[model samples]
Target: MALAYFNGNIVDMDDPVIPIEERGHQFGDGVYEVIRFYQGKPFMMREHLERLYTSAKAIRLEIGKQQNELETLMLELAAKSGLENADLYMQATRGVAPRNHLFPKCPASISITVKPSRELPQDVRKQGVQVVLLPDERWQNCYIKSLNLLPNILAKQEAFEQGCFEAVLVRDGFIMEGSSTNMFIVKDGKVQTTPLSNYILAGITRLAVKRIAEELQVPFVEKPFTPEELLQADEVFLTSTTSEVLAVTSADGRQIGSGCPGPVTRKLYEHFQLKVK
Candidate 1:
């Protein structure tokens, strides 16, 4: 069963608990995180929480609870849903206030929902997916996972209209990342991805892939690459919390690396499964 939580109450998923003046609803003033649980156990819970707090701080909004307290609430919500494999989405906002542009002096509003995991089809995972390259039009603070996602949503929708899974965002002739995933390419047997910066969100799954690469002794490099380079690479792939490690067999309708999920992506994905287990 799916569940919804607001402040300190577990409410019906469709109930309207947030006021019309809630900052998140009015101005997108919030930070959020989607945590995945397998068999009721969370993966990298600490890292996810840290990033959540970091995003809140970057936006000058307080979550109004200690990290451990939020973690406890999340775990309890996930367990209460009775879903062994679940996705817990949590958000912290600047709270309700009368129509105004300034920050309000009110306790932050926290909401959470837990539902069964949305797993991709096995065929799509095995055969890989296509992506469209779009210009990066997000704010300079892309590193902060804030609620202002208009640009990202637009790009993602554009990709979907084109029969693609994700929008690979490019900035200044270099690939930044996907609209919601980190981009990677394999060249000369080395894993290459964009280095951490304000231009891209540092993905936890990307970090996991780096660790898996090291464990397998595969060379991992962090640097920006152009679309031409991606097309010329030995392989292409992407990573995210939901997507995990997914190969990019086509970009902008161009086939990549024999138009299949490459060997390195398969190996890293196998190790990721092991890590989760």
Candidate 2:
């Protein structure tokens, strides 16, 4: 049976006793983070937890457990789940409260779950994936990894309907990022991605990729690029906890650089694989 860490207790996956009036359920007053674990050890767990704390603070939610305590609970839960490779999902909510919009007076409730790891399909990794461009209708505070994600959900659904793997959100004709991933482009043999602003989520994998590019002496640019520029890029890719480094072959029916993963993309992908290993 899959074991889960719920409300400070390790129990069967089905035994999580979330209260009916949980603020996360009623008002989406919560934040979450997913950390990838390889060979039973989480990668960049400190960065993930730091981001989680930042998100919680942004929403005025306080975690009941300290950072070290949460990390211990996560590791213990992963061991109990019996997964050598997995994703640890941690969330903190404002706890159970009456059906009201005001902030709850109680401390937040923390929960964690371990799930089997998922990797990008081999074909996608080799040939690159396709994406559709959609308008960015999310709230202004996109930096916080909040639980309210209706706009993202709808955009991803639209991409799925069009036989695409992800959606590239366009705001004011500029490409922000994928619905759940950070977008990058290669032009003139230089790597480029959007700046860390309220327009996009500051992705941990994205930061790692930037570091890798710098170490390899590759030119990296963190500037805003439009969807038109993204289409014209010699190579387009995305970074996320699960997607890792995946090339994009097409966007909005336009072929990107012979409609295949370019040489630079392949090089970076190989380099990223070594890091994960």
Candidate 3:
């Protein structure tokens, strides 16, 4: 089953909820989150809410509900959907107002939907995926999970056109991250990724990887690595709420480290599966 929520009402997924003047739809003025539920339980729901609120605050928009309240609503909605494995997508917009460049004086528009979780093909995950490097043509505040995603969408489409699964975004000759995931490279048995900055998003799954690495006694370093370094590394991987831990076997038509999922990536993913249980 699938469901949609608008303001305070739970409705059918196909129901018309938001109006034409919604800021999120009009100007992409909002922030959103996707929480994965496994066995009817949410994975890191609190962390997701914290990031959502952080993004809302960064954009000077109020979500108009406490974290716990939002969490409860999400849980109830997911439960109603009855999907054991689900993805709850929620967003908060500035509200429906007259089309203008200034903020409106209306209550924030909160919309949410819960549907089946998406997963890649088993063979694709087993063999790993390919990515193409693209310029980071995005705003400097990439840290905020804002609704403005034209640049990202374009990069992803370009990667798809190039027969790639993802696009690794680069700025100033260094890898920032994937269009939607955090990028990492394994070198000499250590994990290296770009450090947290305004140019990079602090991914929740990336945080999970760090903690799992510490628990597994794997050396995880947060340092920016060049595309050349990534191409020459022992292995490359990416992490995100939806993608989880995925390997990158090639980039820019160049094979990376035997062009297979490496042992470290496999081990980390194995542990990540257990953590989500």
lDDT of 1 by residue, 34-127 (tens): 8899899998889999999999999899888999999998998898999999888999999999979999999999999999988989999989
Give residue 148's lDDT in candidate 1 (0 to 100).
Answer: 94
For each candidate in turn, the TM-score is 0.99, 0.97, 0.99
Candidate 2 clashes between residue pairs 3 or more apart in a chain or in different chains: none
lDDT of 3 by residue, 59-107 (tens): 9998889999999999999998999999999999999999999988999
Model 3's alpha-carbon lDDT is 0.94
User: What's the lDDT for residue 41 in model 3?
Assistant: 97
Q: Rank the candidates by lDDT, best first.
A: 3, 1, 2
Off by over 4 Å in 3: none
User: What are the Cα lDDT values of the candidates?
Assistant: 0.93, 0.89, 0.94
lDDT of 2 by residue, 155-187 (tens): 999999999999999998888999999999999
Sequence-dependent TM-score of model 1: 0.99
